[model samples]
Target: MTARHVLLLTAAAYASDPDGPWVDGGLVLRAAARAGLGPSALDAAERAGLERSPDGRLRLPGRRAVYEAAHPARRRAAHRLLAEAALGERLRPAGLLHRALAAPYPDSALGTELAAAARLPGPSHGERATALAHAAGLAADPEVRAGRFVAAADQARLAGRPHRARELLGRIDELTPTDAVRGAAALVRGLLALRDGPMADARASLLLAARLCPGERALDARLAAAEAAWALGDALAYQEAVAGQLSGAATARAFGLGMAAALDDRYAAGRVTLRRVVADAAGAGAPDALLRAGAAALVAGDVEAACRLGSRALAAARALDARPELPRALELLAYGELRAGRHARARTHAEEGLRAARAAGQRNVLAHQHAILALVASLDSDADTVARHAAAAQDIAARHGLVQAATLAQWALARADLARGRAAEAAARLGPLVRPGPRQGHFAVRMLAVPCFVEAAVSAGDLGAARAAVAEFNVWADRGYDPQAGALLARCQALLSAGDPVRADARFTEALARHERAGGDFERARTAELHGEWLRRARRPARARVLLRDALVAFERCGASVWAVRTAAELRATGDAPSHPEAPGRLSELTPQQLRIAHCVADGATNREVASRLSVSPRTVDHHLRNVFAQLGVRSRVELARLVDRAEATRAL
Candidate 1:
């Protein structure tokens, strides 16, 4: 038999009528003739494949491969023909479907293409199949139209036209509203809001989408909601989003979950998630993971690990030419430097990141940059710069609802007030953040500011407040809020709750060691200064000299002139030769950091050696080394060393 006859026979065999007898040979030949096959021609066709069994029943030879030989289009046509031909004669469709498919579809390029297809008048089988396929495409149900629009919107977004994507999403409502369409629409809106502005809007839209989304798309919608909640600074929402297990061990899923954990300040949990992402990662988003994991490491107090990951992130971003990631990488690098007391290098990184973020129109990064700059200025005792940058950062962070950025900027201003002896006012300024009510503060930021608030409160004679802050800090310490927190807590305890000189001294000593272990030079310096002050008041000026000298050197290394001058006064009161009141020469012109780098180079320390002592990168050491040479009008390390020594000796004389 011909191919059509074989298909007819196959369909007839599989689709038996419950109310009718098996189709015998005579009936098959009659149906074929009615289907336009001539009787003599059908008899002349090959019948080798359609052999009969001993019982006289047709048993066509079939194989799995033979079954796949026919195209789906042909199978569908034969099946439709059998449904009609089995009942009686074929009932041809009126021209309505044909005219609809052939007509110009409003705003549809697809209909135009279908119209171009030949609508032949003759009864050829292929032409009939083609016409039916065209009509079927035009008559697709509303659910199919919604899915098509969702797919088109995704493509438009990938093509960098989010407005076009939103427009296509709007077309979904015009067709029909299925759970799938509404869920997809909400998911896209959430993702877009995440990138465009405040995350509150994104979180709300994503929550509804995750709840209503059905089927395989459910996991994706949940991921979107979790990320939106993280961006909106809600840790609880992130917790719930990852509660439902992911569908697979997908690297993207790991990355999303890992980022949520990190933003929620669950660093240990985030690290676990990041490790999973790394194991499953195919190098697609590994660089992004590196950046986020590095920040988490910094917060966890792993200084060396943070530096290692930061260096890798910077290199990867540059290698991939991932301009969008550059600002974040640079921002993290600056934070690492700031934590390590590498103020000069931190300033460079923050300034560079600010320019990159502004050019990229990343306002979130811009707000963080200004906050970092504010802190840097506060450290440098540049009150005017600190005030200006802090105000700018405050405005941006508040307007954008950035909890962390705003908190950091507020902390910077409070630190400045504390430096200027306005301890009472500083205590008032930080009290709200240090003891936040309900869900009002960022965990990491509050963790960082608590120690400072305790010192401020104690200095302002609010002993009860100081003790309460200390208790709160102990709670954070138990949860492993910060790596350097132990040392800071000890120092606070020594100042606020210690009963004897011996206990206070022991606590101070422990805090100093912890600061060194954590590689926080500025913190160590401040601790030494406080301990020296305590010793001086106890009539042990000689014992105070050693810690006072160390504090002076550390303050100089961090470019903390305001604190350094105070240390100098404390040193002078200890009967030590203090820094010259008006130190003459180029030494005064150089920054405290530059002066310290010069001292290290003058003592013949290598770049790596200096970097180890200063808790900074060798590259940072080299950069500061070069600056020291240029600023002092020297040609080499030798000249830079000689010039610095000569200037110092002259100032003393």
Candidate 2:
């Protein structure tokens, strides 16, 4: 029946029996959210005191106060108020009329209200399935028992636990074989196949189920399977499969089908499908569909829509005490917050999700949580924490046969090493990840490999290989895949190798900008340290000293002992080091920027040429030479060049 009709029936039942099932409000709210209704509507309903109980029933306050005091005619008015409030714009009269007839005392005022609402269209098949699933555990009828088992399977699939759902379906088969039971079993098998990493099997199972059920059950599975096939590049199969299922499935099927279309780059078609899915799911109380709708909204870059849908999903998940969906919902919320530059809130949500995943023993979720944590740590420039978490992730991935995750963990480790001045070690560790090979099963893992390869090549001073690696990275970046800070560092190193010192300096500045935007100062400090080195090489010792000193402070704050020590060494040599209260001027300047600049100039340019190149007049170049005469710097430009070159050579050795 229509949502309005259901609400009217629920209201009448409540009026007649104050304790009757009126908990359908939650389900209605869920459906409305899926249908793309504004959060304001749901909030209004909540404020109006429509809360769903844990048992999936509506809990209205002071049930006897309104119904008992009202006449039969007034009772109908109450039912209308409840129905209008619950269904909102989604209500129609046809479904309401049907609900009226189904209620007790069909000729009563309550029944009349239901009859009027019954004229409206009812929830789509997918919504019906969702509602059935939500109320299944409380249902006692044999048909409902079977349907509940199926709904259980659907829940399992949505939570990424297809294996458990499959097992449950197997048990359901032992009970009886109704159309719903058989259809749900087939759909469950298809979902299981999809989860098992076999799109072909999933498609076949779903296609067969589509012919058998020809309702929401088969339609949902078929569309999901089609999308899987499309993702695997079987476009023709996807089209044929979708075409066959489209004529029978509910509008919500379009959402799943649209997801497939989007994967195939049919953006327009995907948009059309998702819109319908949202509408239909909103009409039928389906939290899973609402979550999908929210995700789609996010993909479309509709921040408002995403927040509305996500809020609804979160509410439903909370109402149901479904802890599994909680993390997924929280992740979406965190993503939104992160986009808005609310890093503190984002981190809070991310940590909450991690805790939930750990409590539930969900390894896949745990892996994702750790990856996010690594990103946070990278932003914070807490190299030790990043390394520890990344290693843990790799260990978990290896144990779970997740090759792509292992690769990412290795990349994270390489980044940690690079930050600690262990470039050679980082190069060795990241070398194997960048080699040409067949596509890894995980998309994230494969994408990660490109940056790791670039970093290693640049670190090892293999400019040719780095250039080649960057060509691949540029492709992914062009496709809208922006790598994280660690990857950006690799890009900066390549720019430095290309000798565009200015652009390289700009890239370092950009990295720091991003780090600060991500709500952490650690990466900014590290970038500043690198920028100082670049500046020092460019003959800007004054500015370099300030940057290096700041970096040293950051390193010490983050407990980065290796980096702190190295920065201190650079500080002393620059003659800009902070004075020790106990031993002032105890540190000696080992090398100076002017000396390096002189070496670079004399190695290739004449005195007049060096003066022009360094933006100094010829007279100043001669004056510096006179000072050079007094200092062990020597008399002639050639001798000065020799001394500076020898010092550089010794340092390199």
Candidate 3:
């Protein structure tokens, strides 16, 4: 056989697989043999018009022209021959493609195989997706086409193509689909709406999906509806979504029910159920389950457990390509770190979570991340950042009825007001949020904000209001959910008991004692500052100096610059100027990511180890480390370690 015959045969083989840009090299070889051409002619054809990619796939240049030029009979022969060859080679997608093309009309047999392969979870997702798309177009029956399109819509959604997913879902309207197939389509639509906004629509679609789907899928749809209800702060909807579903041992279902309990303020029941979620999810493979369980742990006030679960979820989500869960996992870590009083670490996680939420089109998670960032900025007295993030969060929350995000953003704004010493403004701002009213904040957050409300009220000289707020705060503190709640409650009591010197001193002393057992340095510092102020007013300058100085140092160490400044001024008022005021340290100048990398490297973690621990690429670790070194003016890891040691020693003082 001449090289001319090889080119013609290879072009016909390429034409047989016209949907793909190129044909498999093995297909070309099979076609050549069927054409009575020796294997040696293939090399000559390669030197002719046939081209080979670096990946070893075969293509014929001007293949479209070659295909159009070919006789109809020859193309049919090539399709039959190529289909048989693909089957023999066990190329399922290729054989299905060729066999479907060889049919005169839509082929149901080929479409079934293609649809099954496309829906199967595997590494070759793109190939499966392409084959199924072709199969759906050529399917003979309307129901079969609708079913295939349903799977295709799911594949598009999972692949992060929202528009294409919606387009595929639209195709279902033109055909008759079984309830199961229609239900599956609804589930995908609900998930997309759940990620992207309008919580009411998401909840409606999810509830519909739950009713229409099979048993297992119904459970999934219900759990997802529970999520939308949680975001909307619709407790009744949350209960309805998870009703009669708490008996199961599945980690996800238990987590959803636990969250429902949290929304109901049943801390004991929620914590007990969430403990099971934590245990079960530790061994569960689904990243979404781990994320849901982590969220339950967060709501149960188990900050350390939540952080641990969030880390595992983040790593697993990335490994499993679960992009939608990535932001939620990061949110758990950020909020946990914030509660743990690691402001810089919280900032780092919040910053990354915000980006992930935006990329994944999770508007509600995006708003929540913004609120986290806003709170972080409020701590540092960065009013612009606080306002910017809070506004961004509130705007989205208003449009989508995101109650949690709105509550968090408002709390951040009020915290900024209190930090800046606008006590009256802060008190007014927090009144509706903490009290029972039409504009009241979320239940859990409203309770958490009570301490701040009490402080603001006391500072504004509204002792009656402060006392009433403390009475409510006392109830939450007695529950023992938040470790810092007890300490904060004592401080509030001291603020209200200033008229009785002995009672005021006792409450202040109790607050300081409780602070030792709590985790947040910021809260501890607030108590110390308040106690010092009381002592100074009571003509005890020496004791006032000690507490004030301690509060000042703690504030600076935790990056609460405004609080540090206020504490320093209080110390100075006692006629004792602070010797170690806020100083710019190498650690303080670095961004959150850079600072974390510096600390890890200084602790003797290699770049790869840091990357693994943070669930980022080693190259990302290396890049951040270089920026850390440049920012800190450090030449080596040894220098960074020395700097970190000095910073720790300074903070310890």
Over 87-172, each residue of candidate 2 has an lDDT whose tens digit, in order, gives 44343332243234233443334333432332234432223233333334334455655766676566555544545566557656
What global local distance difference test value does model 3 have? 0.77
- Count clashing pairs, candidate 1: 0
Off by over 4 Å in 1: 1-188, 208-224, 248-285, 295-307, 318-323, 579-653
Q: State the displacement of the C-alpha of residue 63, model 1, in Å, after optimal TM-score superposition.
A: 64
lDDT of 1 at 276: 59
Model 1 lDDT per residue over 1-653, tens place: 36445544443333231111232344345446556776454444334345444554444445223435656555444444443443311212212222342234532444333323323332222223333334324535666556556654553443334565567677677776687668877887766555445667777777777777764466666766665565455667766876756663365566556656665557568767665554443243556667756754664455556666766787787776455567777888887787667877788889998887775556767778888888887776435677788888778666666677778788888887776567898898888888858644566678788888988998899988788878978977765636678899999988974468788999999999888876677888989998998899888998899999899788877787656655666775676642433223767787877778778766545566578888998788878877877776676553454455555556667
My TM-score estimates for the predictions, one after another, are 0.61, 0.51, 0.76
Instruction: State the lDDT of candidate 3 residue by residue for 1-653, as single tens digits.
Output: 36766666566655333434676787767766776778679888877778878876787778768666767776666666677777442466666666776677776777777666555444233345456667788787888788778777776666555666788789889787888887898899999888776889899988998989977788889988988887887777888898885433466677777777765668678778888887777687777777777777777677788888889888988887766678888988898898888899999999999888887677888898998899888877345678899999999999988888898888898888887678898899888888877888876678888888888998899988888778888887776668788888888888898889999899989988998987689899989998998899999999999898789779878888756656655665677743443333758888888888877766545566678788898889989988887877776664565566567657766
Clash total of candidate 3: 0
The per-prediction CA RMSD against the true structure, in angstroms, equals 19.0, 17.1, 10.0
Q: Give the range of the ten consecutive residues with the poorest summed lDDT in model 2.
A: 581-590
